[model samples]
Target: MMIHGFHSSRQDFSFGPWKLTVAKMHVMKSANVEKLADELHMPSLLEMMFGDNVLRIQHVSGFGIEFNATYALKCVNNYPGVLKVACAGEWEESRTMGEHYKEIIRPYDWTYTTDYKGTLLGKALKLKVVPMTDHIDTEKLKAREQIKFFEEVLLFEDELHDHGVLSLTVKIRVMPSSFFLLLRFFLRIDGVLIRMNDTRLYHEADKTYMLIWAIQGLR
Candidate 1:
């Protein structure tokens, strides 16, 4: 089975210098699809879509990041070369899209695997992307501290026409000592393979710099 989208009844969250917003509107209607197509100029979007799922995490005077469907799909097309993936006749949407759309998708990965790390925001912030020589304190995050606020937001998702699942999601948990946020892109192609891309962010209430680490895996 497949799901178009889901709704989250919670409001935005804020802890210390961080500000978070989770927007989960219904699936894209025809008008939404048309607008996105016109704006994105990508015919591959003719398959399936969820235009309203967005998650944004910003800082008062620091670095920030955002997750949304529009940019993620854009990455799938711009991902260098064709991926060794296919849904064949299992993908109902691709089958129904006919030949013209298939031609447009032939050069791209129809499985919708995205290498999108996240859309970074804030120019004046003192955020630097150094090598992951250092790390997020796993022991601290694993501690049983008092969680002030927590929320999970689904940025976008697809069932790959019933072949498997591809989705991007972001979640954050705030504790008295510090806060942790995880943004992930996960793909499962059933018997083929499973790949995961993770971006983890951690911040201590007493520090000015936030620790960020990114990891990728395929099997």
Candidate 2:
């Protein structure tokens, strides 16, 4: 299922045991307004730390099941060359069933890591800003495509299940150059996978861009 407009105010969908509803979508743009004001007078520490050119998309969603996906972006030291993208989330069922379901998924063990640097798909997963490339083609790079990229490229699954044997999985992707980040939340119950949310963020030369898709289904 594909949604056509960014102006859509509300949408609802469901699959299997999962149901999703989305509302109140809007875009926001911001610059270093505080920094500009500080420069005219005396600057404080907080004002000096402000960076310019930020764009964000805000939306609300309701999932029949409890679910969340979040990402944090941080600069490596004081240098802008490298950035770190960290992701984490949780899921819980409406009711508890048995001991078997409780132990289905465990907390993320950060001691292990995988390197996808060698394969063809791995190489393509790294997104870098090309000086003159037309990177904002919404037609070629749809919201769904950006979401699917992580599921195909990076492998990160930390899940938990409940009494009904319903499972929740989280996947994350961080580009090598720190230009892009993607997070996906998935719910699996009765041997079927339902995508709950897809969120993507891009840091470009002049601005930060965000795109999101929240989905749910009903019986």
Clashes of each: 0, 7
lDDT of 1 by residue, 77-166 (tens): 544344454564456355446776666643345556667777788877645666656679899898999998887777667777777888
Clashing pairs in 2: 13-216, 13-217, 14-216, 14-217, 14-218, 15-217, 20-216
Compare the candidates by lDDT and give the number of the best one: 1
For candidate 2, what is the lDDT?
Answer: 0.26
> Model 1 compared with the native: what TM-score?
0.80
- Tens digits of per-residue lDDT for model 2 on 31-115? 4433432342311111112121111212122211111211111101122212111211122332223676455433221111111
**Which regions of candidate 1 fall more than 4 Å away from where they truly are?**
1-10, 37-41, 46-48, 79-86, 89-96, 99-106, 123-126
lDDT value, residue 83 of candidate 2: 15
Which residue ranges in model 2 land beyond 4 Å of their true spot?
1-178, 191-193, 208-219
Computed on alpha carbons, the lDDT of every model, listed in order, comes to: 0.71, 0.26
- Residue pairs with backbone overlap in model 1: none
